[model samples]
Target: MSGFIMLKHIKHLNLQYFIKNLPQLSHIMFMEPSYSLQIYHKYSYEYKNGNSNCDDRTHKNLQNYKFKCNSNQKNKEEFNYPSISEETLLALAEYFESFEEHCDSNYDVTYSDGVLTINLPQKQGIYVINKQAPNRQIWLSSPISGPKRYDLVNGIKWVYASDGVSMHELLNKEIPTFISSKKKDIDFTILPFGGKS
Candidate 1:
């Protein structure tokens, strides 16, 4: 069978699995048929040369795949982070500073250089929240949830990349529980800039 026919057959048989497992394959197959044919020919040659481990070969090829990115583009499409303004940074800093007053004597909360460090004696660990200016994201190193990057969405909320949990919501849920205090409602509405209130 021709490589094109074989690919069509594979798609027909397991379209969902093909899309899920080999997303790049679907892209090449649909967007660049000639490239897909080249890939097929290369793999066929490799298979005929005694490289029978298809999984290993596929993984290796994927690792070597050169994803194209335009250097002239002002904003790269791969990253979802938006541009954060200076006023927004100050507002966020102010918001984090408020946590210091609410924290118990045992817990040490400090805000400096757009970074918020929370030392929880009861938890026996530190939580670090910092603004990554280049990425326009807020990174959180949490004792409970490991590391998470949050992007500013809707010009106001810093939302987690994976779970879409807002920074205010995450802190309100986590910090109060960590310090054994009642859940405090954090106000994210008071942005310094004319951002979405």
Candidate 2:
């Protein structure tokens, strides 16, 4: 099989660990997950034999479904997928900060279907791509890992530097309690989003 076909197969297997069955791909292209952030839900219903009130309750119950994942990491060295919690967001932000050539001001953020899509500054060795839903989150592998679906409702959101924001600046500017003791370094080329242009 071709590399594209193999890659799709890998993503298919990865998705099975979260979704009930393999996800239906409308078309087969090598587009990174970041470019696609649409989430579709097909609601289902069932008829119940009872009073109107009982029927209402039964219908509600049938509609109340959730997503859960079975742990299936392809690599033993990789860390478990982080939750989308505030801390996880922070961790991601920190990861971005560690890049040698920090390409700031080249990021974007959008929200759809309760999932937050964050585009980070691209750098060498960091291939990031992501598509997230409230229940299932998918990302293209970087120096980290390739694209895979994960559960994050209860998972902590580890914001890393990769999220493309200066944690020190945010903490100092947004949250006063995190004041740093050392003198802040200034970058003259960094543009007004207060990031390196």
Candidate 3:
């Protein structure tokens, strides 16, 4: 009866909500040791099964995941990996530029050199996309999920090193949703690739 219960592995947001509502819960009989224990067990199960009531929009805000790196680097001489060609880089820049023009004015997009930045309104955060010439990768810093690195495969697609999600697919899924509104339906497909329409 003197020991304590440690809630391990609870997500940060869930923990915050629990702590915030503890006083209210206590007022409603949760202060009783047995009731508290029952509540804790119920929530613990929910957390483990990914059924927590936390809002989906804010779930990815926690930057706790580790980024994956290339494992094929075996020697210092081999460190200099092949990067995307100038032509491909130009195409990507053009693509981003087109996206900027089509997206709602609420967002501020900029592309310079090999970097493309999408600055969202306050509270939404920013996304940074750039080419890692030395690593032969395309790197993304997502406001929602933190940093991810992508490598080109088959001379056509840039794929995330950890999950194999293509850059084209990720942007197509994320960007439109971020800027969606009643009047605007942004199409990420407008991004030009190697002169293709």
Candidate 4:
């Protein structure tokens, strides 16, 4: 209880220096219930149905809470089988191969079997696009967006459910930054637009 009050008081008084200057409180602050900059909603009892508005949480014994609004979950039938995902991933790999051939020597793109790998210029890192055939999803490990699973929507585009941004939209926004800044001629047509490029 005192730990909670002291944490609250410290924030209320904005006593960052005081806390930092005293190393003794450091052990207490990070112990078990760590006080952080973000507010944590720790429910004592099982979470039933409420307003259905929650972002992120964790529960060891209690029932976990879920976001009821804007879930953006689509029907499994909407995304086609292996053909759609395989074709899309392969097409992207070819586009990248063309880009790597035209772009700087540092950039590289590769595709084999059902996986596509792209190594960016400088130390920017690589992008991995692979087909999860069973799930009918295109999983991407991008240098800019980390890891994300994309599902084809309405047979028109590959969409990320968490933020509703399509695979084409994200690549369109980011891929140009690396190309346009260095080269004079960059064909954006190769990048997917309203549909598969």
Candidate 5:
């Protein structure tokens, strides 16, 4: 049978196994009838022929190789991250700028050029929060919680993908420990954190 006919009859398990064995066959079969296989084959051919000049080899699996070349590869939500990240970091910086001054003479909150540095005295430790524009992330280096890279997800929060924890959660928990000494309780609800903003 022809490759097209074989593609019609192949089961999912067999298809995966076949793709694993004949990696080039993925370029031949993993596509819709109307989709162009020429570009996919060109990449697979160049990849197999020792043309390591381009980044096609980095896709891991030769299957679905066509997506790497497609301009619309990223989903809609992913495209929104840059703007969300910018807003989130800016909100965080603004809040800390005002909050730090009243808390302690020894504590310093400095926000300059997309970096927010919180210096707490008496071994409370230094906090460095900065906007990583390229990665679309806000990096936090906290004394109590170590480090985490937060992505701006659907809820308008800077969330660490690993532990499902928001940057606000860590700050609300840890910030009070160092700053809530003046008979005043921290109101985390008022901060410009999560929700549809």
Candidate 6:
């Protein structure tokens, strides 16, 4: 298939997957057929002796030798981690790797003359962050604004979503209810009590 065709196929598959799994996708754009065909020729012919490289004896031997060594090492480690499933351990390792990447991607917090700013990508519109710690309190505000204060943390369980809900629902209402339901110790004031005598 031409590069243009391949790109279209890839894009189509991606769109289809998103449509089926995620109900939140607003739209999916497809690559133009003309653009796909032009790129196909460029990718297919640019490689040097592609099939011959695979057939090389030295390369074949090296690949097989490396594969056997890797297989044996993996087998040995399987027994070593008998207490923990290999899949779970692998997942934990993958999670940490992605966590490190997330930390790297987050903006640096800067403070200057009573103003605190967190520089982030401009593509994100009207950025709002609600952070909370188990020890202290829930923080609500734009990270670009000022110093973060942590009083007695409001028992919250907010979720960042594209759904149209008022900030009251986003912060005050739904979160505490969710937390209260989840943990019995988390006593949530779902509805404010009357202050009347």
TM-score of each: 0.47, 0.24, 0.47, 0.54, 0.55, 0.15
Instruction: List model 3 lDDT by residue over 57-121, tens digit each.
Output: 32332211100011112221243334344444555555555555445566676777788777764
Two-way TM-score contest, 4 vs 6, winner: 4
- Across 1-197, the per-residue lDDT of candidate 6 in tens digits comes to 22112223433432223223222221111112233333323322322335322234434433343344344334333332222222222322232232222333442444333222333333231222332333122233543333232221111222122222222333334322222233333212231210110
Worst 10 residues of 5 by lDDT: 27-36
Point out the higher-scoring one by TM-score: 1 or 6: 1
> Which residue pairs clash in candidate 6?
3-40, 4-36, 4-37, 137-153
17-134: candidate 1 lDDT, tens digit per residue? 3323454343223223344445545544554575555565554544343222121122222334433544555565566556665565666767777777778755568888787866
lDDT score for residue 161 of model 4: 56
lDDT leader? 5
Error of 4 at 23 (Å): 53
Quote the lDDT for 47 in model 6. Answer: 25
The clash count for each model shown is 0, 31, 0, 0, 0, 4
Candidate 2 TM-score, true structure as reference: 0.24
Cα displacement (Å) at residue 170, model 6:
12
For candidate 3, the 10 contiguous residues with the lowest summed lDDT are 63-72
Q: Which ranges in model 2 have alpha carbons more than 4 Å from their true place?
A: 1-87, 99-123, 129-131, 143-145, 153-197
> By the lDDT metric, which is better: model 1 or model 3?
1
Q: lDDT-based ranking, best first?
A: 5, 4, 1, 3, 2, 6
lDDT of each residue in 75-141, candidate 2, tens digit only: 2113343333333334434443433143445544444443334454442233343544332344433
> Model 5 scores what on Cα lDDT?
0.57
